[model samples]
Target: MMESMVIFHRCRSLAATDAFYIQQLGLTLWHTQPGCHIYDSGYGYLGFVEAADFELPAYSCISFNCTDCAEVDRLYEKFKGMKGITAPRRHPQFAVYSFFIQDPDGYTVEFQKIVKEGEQ
Candidate 1:
């Protein structure tokens, strides 16, 4: 079995992206390369590489699973009033309570909690 995983993405400015992931999202810096920085999300690692010509993807989403609905709500409160943040709501079709926010690099970041297990 795989022991761990890391998702890599491109960013224009490491400082800005770093601040968003570190200060805003509260992810801890896990590792660093010459032009890339990786953050530990407590579940997995996310790596951002500096790319001057990076283009934002239309349908790419980075999602985090919370422990429960209240945890999702707590994250919603932290991200509220931020640009591109949506109000948290239940998605019966997906059986989750979730919301989305745009990262500094225009990436879609979702926070969700499973409300019903083995339903969908």
Candidate 2:
């Protein structure tokens, strides 16, 4: 059984990435090293490594699950009016209330609240 999780990425600006994740996204700083910085994601951890030739990924997105729809709406307000942010909306196909935002490294981070059975 899989019991653990971690997501890692290559980033060019450690300070910018840290500020975006910690200040903007509200993730906690878990640790740091010469090559990478780690953030606590409640259930797991996210790591970003310093790189010189940083190229954005073609088809990758990291998602954070909120406790409820209100939290998702709160985060939508928090990230609204920012650069590279999509309007917060619902995904009927997936039954998710979510919004997408691009990080400093141009990675899409999705904040979502899943609809439980009989709630949709």
Candidate 3:
């Protein structure tokens, strides 16, 4: 089988960034170097490196899917004291409960849980 990974181009604080994702977001560090690192996201991998000129784009770029609203809620509470977090909201049109969080470098990560039929 073919293999691939997701890598964020640049980062400011490698330790801080790694801690947030690994400790707070539950992603695990899989590899590391002086200015680069990769995370094990269970299903795949995520990586980042130091870059002085790095600037996050203005958009919701990536998302993590949870089993349900309760799971998303649990994560929200755990991360509420952290940096960037948008309160959870439900969208009937999309049948989803979700929120947004920004990394230390300003990159946005979305958390979502799908509402099964009749729940919407």
Q: What is each predicted model's overall lDDT from 0 to 1?
A: 0.91, 0.87, 0.81
TM-score, model 1 to reference: 0.92
Give lDDT tens digits, candidate 1, residues 3-89: 999999999999999889999999999999999999999999999999989999778999999988888889999889997999999
| Candidate 2 per-residue lDDT over residues 1-120, each given as its tens digit | 987676899999999998999997788999999979999988999999999999888878889999988888888887788777786678968888888988888888898888888764
Model 1: pairs clashing at backbone N, Cα or C within 3 Å: none
Q: Candidate 3: which stretches are off by over 4 Å?
A: 116-120
User: What is candidate 1's local distance difference test score?
Assistant: 0.91
Please provide TM-scores, in order, for all candidate models, with all chains considered together. 0.92, 0.90, 0.83
| Best prediction by TM-score | 1
- How do the residues 43-119 of candidate 3 rate in per-residue lDDT, one tens digit apiece? 77888898878777655456888988888888898778656788999965788899888888888888898888886
Candidate that beats the other on lDDT, 2 or 3, i.e. the better one: 2
* Backbone atom clashes (below 3 Å) for every candidate: 0, 0, 0
Indicate whether candidate 2 or candidate 3 has the larger TM-score: 2
The residue pairs that clash in candidate 3, if any, are none
Error (Å) of candidate 3 at residue 77 is: 1.4
